[model samples]
Target chain A: MNASEEYEIMIGNHAAAYACKGAKVQVVAAYPITPQSPVVEKISYFIESGELNARMVRVESEQSALVACVAASATGVRTYTATSSHGLMLMYEILCWAAGNRLPIVMNIATRAVGAPWSVWTDHQDAFTVRDTGWLQMFCEDNQEIYDTNLQAFRIAEDPCVYVPTLVSYDGYILSHTFMPVRLEPQSRIDDFIPPLKHHLNLGDMNVVKGVCPVTTPHVVKREEGTAPGYYEFRYSLQRAMEHSIEKVVEVHDLFAEKFGRSYGNGIYKAYKMEDADIVIFAVGSVASESRLVIDKLRAKGIKIGLISLKLFRPFPAKHLREVFKDIKTVVVFDRDVGYGYEGILFTELKSALYQLKNRPFIKGYIVGLGGRDVKADDLINGVLRTIELEKKNEYVEQTEFIGLKLDELDFLKKGGKVENGR
Target chain B: MTEEKDYQKILASVQKPVEGEAGKTGSWSTIKPKINLDKCIVAKMEKNVCHFCWLYCPEPIITRTIPPRILYDYCKGCGICVEVCPHKAIEMVEESEL
Candidate 1:
């Protein structure tokens, strides 16, 4: 309840809500979903208690929730929503509308494992599913970041130069439900930092006469004559927005730190003991926080290893990583979500980002922590050791080594072959 | 009289563009829809009534008057009006057949 610069223990969902409240959002449209329910619940409380002056819309489904935000955002009002797992998946259709219409709708996804057999726990799969959906995706390390990222997300989303919908994500259950000390920024300062959201295609404007979010009419950019813009132009513009927002994300992160005295790697990626190190571990979210202790433990054992935690995933900081990887000899990329048929999503992105750069590290991909599996120091140490061992033998490292995976747990490897889903 | 026009720069109209890039779809027609005047609802049998074809036309090309006329120039004839017509009044015929 302390609106000033005061530290208090709060769960990640509440911290996100506190940041949402601080942003002075005009419309909050959300549905109840696991790990994401408390966020809207807290927002509803804020609305009921007169703490937040916004419409708290409780929609029956996540699709309607996002579509409502899209409509509200189109009319020049700041809109926010939070969802996770199946809710995010249910929102898949309208997500494109939010981005294609170029509405600066800020959302938070408590990253959760996608279900087939129904498990409600933390994993990157849900958020990773929407990487190509034209939104700036960022992952947070802890509850503090969940708050900070939400605050930055509005600025990043609403920037006239960007105008791309943004999603700030944190690990479900691990950070979403876990209580931790969060420093609340002063309301006055937050007001000063994030300016009011403005729609580029303001529905209130007299000039905007036609309906938008148009259907398919040849996806080519019609530069010839008698047309507004083509699908290709908008698509290219979204990409341009993403590329431009990289600098904006870093800039606003540093600006937030300057004002509130807190920033995580200036809002793109944070490094832990990266200086004077020959090897590094690159990962995202809670793994980054735990890697700090892992780095400490490894450095104690004379391993010149460091950790680089990726905060922004969408505008994937390719050039920054390329520059960093050029200086290292080896990097272990641990992704909590698998890219399924290929490799880990983050690992694939990291490897390709640094693939062409001269003197790039011998990057090794390790898939870990699927379905909220725990990643202890031993799991991380073993992954690192495997990477170093691969480098020693001059062996071609496999694309993905499933960390902490017990083969015996597989249905096929079980004593009784129990076919699932009646297949 | 002396003004030179850049066709690419000039807008097709004064109003805002529609979803199909304000496409002048009037030229998309190859075969046009011909209404059977005898069986037409508004024109022949039921005057000032039953504009089902007009309501069901995918394109806003059918206007209900004394007889609902199909704006064949813009109508990419898909037989939607024929399918929806209450009196079997509308029919799609080849431009050459006309």
Candidate 2:
């Protein structure tokens, strides 16, 4: 271990908080919510003990928390906040404001299931809700990954070339409350890695009077002999930034690896034992971590199977996925959340991504572990084996199938006569 | 080589603070307020006194001086200054009549 590296058993939430401290975040505004509460609590502790020089604004609501971060970020200071589930829903409106303003705010999300029946468990539904908010989205597998990705998130978000907000998410309770050994890099090295925020626009500067994110017209207009772009152009710029941030993400990841001696493959998707495999398992977050076990089990049984753990979700990494899936014959995707009326969210998007490939492999998707349902290794293994069986028989498998669903013996559905979409 | 489209050049929705950003808002109105020097407090008194019109103008085009002059270039002709005039010296006249 490097002399500057300190190893300790840390929870994912604490690890994320340490990353914010190491990055020298100037402002943290957050409301405590289940799973995501500890992250802000730890940050508050660090600020109170004087270990980190920052302001911890105790906000009453998650909406106000994110809004406070937005206001802080506008002044060209590094800002951070954390939330989950209903808290994320509350901050939905301001999420667009932060991205549209290009404020480069970094938010960590402990992925949790949204309510109705009220579940406080691990799921991807909360983070997926804001996938289109022009923010870069990343899901980390383990606690170490949670810490490492949080540091990288700030660098990625604040890059002047890609001045967009970012969401660093991990499975709630699964990673948030779980403890694991993580190596914390020294403050000096982290400082060298992520320098203070620099941007083309600084709302903090009083000398230069400027208006930020004003109500723009539908078309470009002339103001005091100067041309200003309209709302459409502003939104287009945000879209363009997201499209172009893919490169910056890889570059930053590579740079971080070069400096810290650690990196996720291509900074987008990490492929495991896929060099000679024909069938591969695709998943993200904790599900992807579980697929590693499935890969080992399948390989031991003389099956040529591998796994691809997705890290970057937004900007989708379609190009990298296409490159990796080129030689594979079949891909089985496991999702912790469903797209409701449609199939698994990742499954549909992956299909669209590979639609252009002339020799695209047959792909299938499985919905697993919704609302923190226990996804057993046996179930994942069975799903993959079933997929292989279907592939060999050239059987047309359903777009989405369920794993770990115990409704087979349940009599509730049986009592409801003439269900239109009964399984 | 064809020129590539640069989104960065657009710089999103941010812009330097400038006057008349909404275009000459004065054109939006049909009536313009005219101040009568005969009954104007500041104009008749010839001293720096109460220029309520200048303070009450929404667009705030009325300048606080010896006789409070309105900068008509960007004023929306809201007639707010006429309402706030204590001396009843300001009146709104139709732009077409002028």
The prediction achieving the highest lDDT against the true structure is 2
Question: Candidate 2 chain B TM?
Answer: 0.74
The candidate that achieves the highest DockQ relative to the unseen native structure: 2
**Per-prediction backbone clash count:** 0, 0
Comparing to the true complex, what docking class would candidate 2 get? acceptable
- In candidate 2 chain B, where is summed lDDT lowest over 10 consecutive residues? B1-10
Model 2: how large is the Cα RMSD against the reference?
6.1
Give one digit per residue, the lDDT tens place, for model 2 in A201-230: 667775663554244889877655466678
TM-score of each: 0.80, 0.83
In terms of TM-score, how similar is model 2 to the real structure? 0.83
Candidate 2 residue A389 Cα shift, in angstroms, is: 2.3
Give a tens-digit lDDT track for model 1, residues B1-98. 43432321221112333324446575676777788888886886657799888788776678868777776556777778888887887778888775
Compose the digit string of candidate 1's lDDT tens values, residues A219-330.
Answer: 4333433345455665666777778789889888899889988878757789888888899999998777778889999999999999999999989899988877788999
Interface RMSD (Å), each candidate?
9.3, 3.8
